[model samples]
Target: MRTKDENMRVLVAEDEEVLAELVATGLRRAGFAVDTVYSGDAALAYLGLHDYDVVVLDRDLPRVHGDEVARRLVADASRTRILMLTASASMEDRVQGLDLGADDYLGKPFEFPELVSRVRALRRRSARPVPPVLERHGLRLDTVRRTAHRDGQELDLSPKEFAVLQILLEADGATVSAEELLERAWDANADPFTGAVRVAMSKLRGKLGEPALIRTVQGVGYAL
Candidate 1:
């Protein structure tokens, strides 16, 4: 049985290069796996390749229009939620975007915190919403607060370590492959063979300590 508590994968589909990178960076810092695309066409292609939990789409995109992209996603019945962003703040624009199948709408010059909050809210309404906190094997993880504790002792963890731990806990004892961990915790630019996952797991185990909860399945993956 697969659990829907996997790390939230996000796509930022904005034509503005700076804004796209900024949003992606912000989301990544917030402990989400993010990818960016500067055009609606590119967004569509990425969507076809990966299953993203949310797509922050810009309404005015180069190559293909954002409206068409939303229509296509809706027509295909994708599980990916759409957060439409536009320069227009008019009620008509919001309604039009919603009618076009966007799950939520945000106007330009918006607050970054609000965007993150909106993304979290949208994700919570997915097939199975994960709690803000996760506990397993005497370890506790606070997703929103960005903190971790093991047996009531506070554990200092880096961003990568925290993300890896989160993914493992969300797996709910299921064996999660290294590729899936990299895909869900790191960005698209991360090289698969860089041993990054191995390094992160080592640090995480050190922080987690004692009982050696994380188990490597040799030819498979890691499970807790």
Candidate 2:
């Protein structure tokens, strides 16, 4: 199926810089293109600029305040999903956040893994259902089984390679930027200056031999 990072984007709004950065790092490691803002207003501005799959918002935010941000996002009724966070873990607080149109809620002092899982769940809800299998250009991918075949021959691929290929297939011949590939296939900690994407692409191309299926757009990105 589609991984959390496959074309999925996330916005993290937290007043606390350290916590916000930590959360952003974790989500990025989990393979999401994550952006962080320290205030609710910044979050709103970023939301206006880009379409995100999910937003991890802290209730206690400066500037516009988290509650108002959630309200405005709900009113917009954009496809962006929200996961509200707060130190107040009371039943009433949980109900109130949900009432404000938050797709999910988590209290402060939460586990990092749990936050990642919740974000992924919210992203799945916001994204269109992924097809079980994808086939194009002599390549066939079984998303459910996590397998790939070309010209009826099985292709052994690493997790990163598989993820990269899936993104290209989903693009349907559209050029995918190298930055986009790194965001979706690698973690936030990946060194942007490194040749990680290039190496992985080389390996992938080697495996999917014959007539080149992937084409480089020269500074634009790669298209298949």
Which candidate's lDDT is highest? 1
Candidate 2 whole-model C-alpha lDDT, 0 to 1: 0.85
Candidate 1 global lDDT: 0.90
The residue pairs in collision within model 2 are none
Backbone clashes in candidate 1 total 0
lDDT of 2 at 81: 94
lDDT of model 1 at position 105: 98
Tell me the tens digit of each residue's lDDT in model 2 across 71-166: 999899878899999999999999999999899999989999899889878877897755778999889998657789999999998767888898
The residue-by-residue lDDT of candidate 1 on 119-198, one tens digit each, is: 98888876687778999999999988989999999999987788889888988898998988888788777899899899
Error of 2 at 112 (Å): 1.7
The model with the greatest TM-score is 1
In model 1, the clashing pairs are none
Q: Once superposed on the true structure, which residue ranges of model 1 sit more than 4 Å away at CA?
A: 1-3
Question: Once model 2 is optimally superposed onto the true structure by TM-score, how far is the C-alpha of residue 78 displaced, in angstroms?
Answer: 1.5
